[model samples]
Target chain A: MNAAYVNVSTPHADRNISGIRLAHNRLKVAVFVFLLAFLVTAARTVELGVRSGAVEQSLALDIVVEPVQYGRADILDRNGEILATSLPSTLLQADRFKVQDPVVAARQLVEILPHLSYEKIHSQLVGKKGYVELARQLTPNQKWAINALGNPAFEFLEDEERIYPHGRLASHVLGFVDVDGKGRRGIEGFLDYRLSQTDQTQDAIRLSLDIRVQYALTYELRAAMNAFQAKGAAGLVMDVNTGEVLAMVSLPDFDPAEIKSTVEGARFNRAAQGVYELGSTFKTFTLANALDQGTIDLTDSFDATKPLRVGRFSIRDDHPKNRILTVPEIYTYSSNIGSAQIALEIGKERQQEFLGSLGLLERPSIELTAVGVPQLPPTWGKAATMTVAYGHGIAVSPLQLSTGIAAMVNGGRLVPATLIHNSEGWQEGKRVIKPSTSRKIRQLMRMVVTKGTGRYANAVGYRVGGKTGTANISVVGGYDRKAKISSFVGVFPMDDPQYVVFALLDQPKGTKKTFGFSGGGWVAAPVVKSVIARTAPLLGVAPKKEDASLYETVSLMIEE
Target chain B: MRRMVTGLAVITAMASGAAVLQLKLAVQDKTDNVRKIVQDIQVDERAIRLLEAELAYQTSPNRLQEQSNRFLALMAPKASQVLADPSSIPERPAGARVDSSIDLTVALEPEVKKPTKKRLYKRKGAQL
Candidate 1:
């Protein structure tokens, strides 16, 4: 068959050979392409395998890393104590169409969560609506227990609930959030935007408040308030140099956890919001203002032998000293006559400017939304000047008084009162008064505590110096002598003032222990003394023996 | 040589296909593991937050004060009790020794003697 085919196809051999060669070339090309594709795939596989180890390790690590959603950043104290936080909660919802037995499910739910009323659950379950909320703020354990019931209709929506673990502690500062997680009051209201901003990496908001110090202040203030039978009370502790409010308490404070239980009166932040003629505490500012302006020297004398007559009003001291009182004597005796005379010496324009520079003639610039504007006199006449010098005509918040006093003692620098912790050390405040003036004021304040009306506020070794202000509450057309605002503004370690503690009792009644006197020395000074003694050590203010030179600088020799 | 090359190519193709399949399975397993671990971590984080809140609530100052008043009869420290300087603290009495170890069983024992129960009696002066 081969010989016959060869003989017949000799002429076509060339064409057959050419076709065969073409087919062979095509096969070679196909083999080459197949080999090339396989090699490329193999190389890719090897490369992927080599990188897979890193990818595997990352995958394993990813399992342990989970994003934490706080919803709102936590509010923490200076010591990192959690003041306010958010906890994960589940809101249980049910589809009415899918529920097998509404009555049974409701009964079961009420059994698991006794806080939810059976009636409310039943109504929600059997409602005509397609979907209904069964319960909210359910814990993980509760969610699991409910899920075990195998009800497809039931669904859980993950949510967070803001919780204040400290209850009423620092409630006025930390404030409370509304149902929709909107900040409503205090720091919550002031820095709500920053707190609610969606940045999980952001750290908790650290406030200047120290819980330990707050506890001490609150305990003492409450005790004093109860003992005096006062209508309300407020207290604040602030860093003199940094202007950081360590502790601020305004009673009758309400629990932030239960917003509905809070009364309207209880919600008032007395320290920063309530404006009052803070009585004798104003005398410190008056004396400091005079000293700062160099209008009055420490040896300057004023006759307090008789009540000073100014138009229809007569400015008199509660504890009358029928003699010529020097500048130190006036401060120590809390002589209204002396303070008024000093105010006259300073003049109206200078007094207003001085007070304005100290941030007392305007609204206190704090982080709280609830701040009171100073109720200045309609006209700055002689009577208004005299009355304001004794802390009666002009009304300012306790925060302003503390801030002004802080400026006077803290080397005459006007440090703005701040609720946020200043992590960048002591802020450089604008110079409000001369350093020498501040030093003289400190000496005078120390003398007041050592020998005058503020003696009760003297803490041993702490060298507490302060002034007492007990002003009659102004009523329509007249002042009610019985209802007085007793307050004390105290600075401790007077040689170098670090903190200012201001405490006040509104409409405090006289008690037997107080010798039937609702004066600041009797009612408020003791609170300041107690707070200082307790918190000074905690604040790390080392106590030293009173230096003889320091006493001599502020001491005044009274003539008979 | 051609036959040998074909044989080698087939083996290489088979091995590479198996390796790719194995790698795909391993990747799937790792991904599932990572996903599971992430879920677990989330659960744990939630639990930790809840615990922290509960702990804070339990240890709140007000509640502690109330408990101390009721159980321990503890009172707040007075200003006089707070000495300004540690050096001002009076020296301990002679022969007094510091004991570091706290015996809970002994410490837990009541400090005060329990009051005796009063006997019930009928009084002729008092009318029921």
Candidate 2:
């Protein structure tokens, strides 16, 4: 060992010796630092974990678990008929990670759910980070099929699902929810959060729609539309006192159950989204305004011998048995000249205010999102007043017009329309006109039905009173005389004025019986009359001859 | 033996204390969870109320009966069946009029005599 190779004076040894020492020193330092870091880490770990036992203890006490509860709510109609409600439901989910051959599992799932996309399901199971996979909503049979798999991965989230037993009936009104369970439209849209929410547990949504009345309205409207060869139609009935919308329909309405489908013209809610000149129906407001404003008395006579002329336009009546007409006679005859005269007397400002007060000057808002903006007279001048008096210069959503009419003849009290069955809450009061004005309007409307354009709408013992309107379509260029918008607004039990029913036809073709005339009286009146006859009983309004005087007023007026 | 017994007792006490702490934490977590649940339930209830109201609003009958001649299958009540309260039906006077006077003779007068004369003379340059 003493005689080992020694480089006492070699340049390589002299220079390389320091390098070796330095390298060795660095290596030693590295080892010391490593040991020091390891010891410190171990100490801290002991201090915080094993010795203190703090984290472990804290983990055991974390609290954030969901609890289950029971009980639900009740639904009823305006007359207390249940429209939609909730019952118990079972939701199925699969733990994909626990599943053996996801492909095989998917195939089995397909056997149970024919609607399921087997490939899509297989892909999800094969490539998923989450443990569970939602197979599909299960019926009892589908649940059984999954149970046959006997996989522990399968689990059910006990829940409740909203159900509308009446399929396709008032579907648009009731609306629907998504698979994740969210309401999309109708009453469901209005009360989405409330119905979807859980207290300690379950809840329900109640509506004020009577399915019976809805069916009646839809059925009769469909018939009339078919009979009249109408391109499109809309109808509605409202409860006057409460402003409760009783029946509403738009031809080509969509089914709420299949809310995704764009079938025919069903997507449009005609009653709320469509606007048109309601022809002679405007006469109802004209007569009422005249009476309410003290512009004309019921006995006042108007010389309707010649068409009234105003600024390059001449007013014309649909039925041309021209003669001098009394105030009541003008109403019973549906004399446009008389209505225009009355509007002139009422003054432009008063007329504008009356229409504005009726909610006809703006887009309608009654909880639902579907609505149409009204086309009103920009300048409330004499011409606008005269024209608007007959529902020509202005157009409004059917709902706005219905609510307006409801407030008008129903004693001038405007009630906010509601679909929800109010659960004993504060009621709203908005008075639009005097009660005597409403009564006179009712009498005039009765006169119109008994002898004038609305005669077709007379419903026997229902004492139906109404007015008809026929207007030349005002198109982009000007007015299309060939295309007519015929409409009728009517009141049932005219002796007392219970409900206001309004119907309109968009470009109805003239029938042989109409003498090839597409006027409101010939085209839209029969529809209104039939509806009154049918829906009067279902609405719990027993028809009776309550007012012999009502008939007498119209009868005497017509005879003169 | 006594020392061994005492050590065993201390270990047992410590383990029991750990369990007690775990249980306390669980209870606290449960309370917080319950409070959160109540909040969620309140939200859900609100949604339910909205849905209830919205459904009715969308399905309201007056909404259906709004349009002119809106057809319905309902029959006019028989004379013996009129309701005692006729005011129950909603009516609006603002935009409605019962008497609308139109002189049909005026619109027809312009066309009635002109169409026949125009048809009677179809000559190449028929002057007045």
Candidate 3:
């Protein structure tokens, strides 16, 4: 019985051991599977954290990159109005290797772009193995027509074209870019480095111009030019205190986009680039300088009884007051004889120094590239001094004259004229004359409008004070007796001077309305008057009742 | 006890791994959304620039002057038409009815005049 029980127990024990071993093997397999899954998951997590980030970063870079290249930034007016801008235009290119037939492609292109020469397009596409630009600056219609052809040989390249929307209104100011997108003239050339930075995200350059004022000035000037049958006209409006040019117009002006068709004379900026002998306007400078130097006073009288004889030159007034005229009378009447005597008193060296101080002897320090260098006499002789006193021997641009006049009236500070809009009301500048001298000069200018040649310049409710300058155009040997440069420089609300509006007409023939007189008072004064009347309200200058005492003071001064 | 600890460790690791995977996916989605938004913003900016240029061209002073000459009765304000002070405005005609709802006196209060220095002058008849 013991042997049989032992056998049974041994068998049971063996079977139990076998079952445990099998269970252990299954557990081992399960543990291996679980470890493998954990390893796989850990590796996937690492890949997502490290490798995927790089992939996503490269994908993001690819999505963000743009192929379009913007050329230059925009040019805006002081009021944030667009003066010049770059527009995205399509350029058509052709691949000769891909072309099925060059004749067909050129024909289709010419139909789309009528302005393009078919011969030129055919020549460019016939033998060009690489890509060749068939036409550039294509209109949207042209681009669509080319696209409709669905030619594999054609490709569209993105490009930028500069456009001026106002068209000849501020042409001299905005200028034009060349075919290579390089700025060629005007503000475009002056500020090329700043404008052509190619930064896609940058603010536009804001000029000091006011477009409304510019339009008003140009309209009045053009109307006057047409009415007077003048050869050309130039006008400028500037802030007296700040030296900011509000408007500058030179006509006949060219459309900036169609520069190739315009004549070279149309491209000349008469307001800034052409130097002329601006006549009696220089009297203001002489008188102001004399008063500042204490060499002459308002009560001092000059001999205008005859043509002032300085050697071979005879300085005679256009409208001669043939008597001993006081300084105020000389300025108001624009007496060239009296002015020559006063300049003789100032002398040549002092006169040169004074004009030099006024920035009249050097190139105008404005932003435009086409500024004219003032033409001075070869020898600063006595005759030269007398002639220059009445504005004959020395030639300066209208811009320089305006600047000098502004300094004489704007509390005696010679502020440099600027085309950039800084938004500051007044600019600090070098003092060229005493404030007392400036006040006396203002009084004299007001006297001109009140009692003298600038009577037509007085706009109603705006105290327009100015001087009229009618200079004869110089010819080969002498001055032309018929053709003249008639100009007026007027400042409005004369009590507190704000703006200088200058109008000039070159070779303006006498109109029937002007009674056969081609003088500054008749031709240019009316232009300044209309400009002040139209733009003063827009410039936010309010109209006030006539100050009785101010007129009384001016009248008393004139009487004295 | 050891077996239980091992099972607990494995479960915790798996759960944390799943959370991390979900977080990464959410981050990627947000990044993609941000990229799309940036692209949309750039597109809108370009559109706005183009529209502004168009508006400027349409309302340029030259064009407006032409349009006004053609179609409008309005003119630029004259110097006499502009007044500095509201009190300086002329009174309404006597027969015109006043608006009862609005009080205009507060807006039309007269400003005090500053004292000015007097000058010696003989007065002329009908002088301004």
Judging by DockQ against the true structure, name the best candidate: 1
What does the lDDT read for residue A389 in candidate 3?
Answer: 89
Candidate 2 positional error at A479, Å:
3.2
lDDT of 2 by residue, A233-321 (tens): 78777776677677777886765646667587776777887777665667777777778878888778877888888888888766655
Compared with the true structure, what per-residue lDDT tens digits does model 3 show for residues A1-560? 43554466677867876887899999999999998998998898688677755665764534453533457888999998889988778888888789888888888888878888888888888773588878888877888888899998889998887878777878898888998899988889988888988674266899999998999999999989999999999999999899999999999999988889998699999999989999999999989888999999887887778986667667777887678887888898899888888888888888989999999999988889888889998888888888888888789998999999999999999999989997778787889999999988888898899899999998988888999999998888889999999999999888889999999999998878889998999999999999998899888777776665655654564532
Give the residue spans of candidate 3 off by over 4 A: A1-69, A127-129, A199-201, A551-554, A557-560, B1-33, B90-128
Model 1: per-residue Cα lDDT at residue A45: 59
Assess the local accuracy of residue A528 in candidate 2 as a C-alpha lDDT between 0 and 100. Answer: 77
Q: Ranking under lDDT, best-scoring first?
A: 3, 1, 2
The per-model DockQ list reads 0.31, 0.12, 0.29
Fnat of model 2, as a fraction = 0.28
User: Would you list the clashing residue pairs of candidate 1?
Assistant: A280-A469
Error of 2 at A450 (Å): 1.3
Candidate 3, position A301, lDDT: 81
Order by DockQ, highest first = 1, 3, 2
Task: Tell me the TM-score of model 2.
Answer: 0.67
* TM of each candidate vs. truth: 0.86, 0.67, 0.83
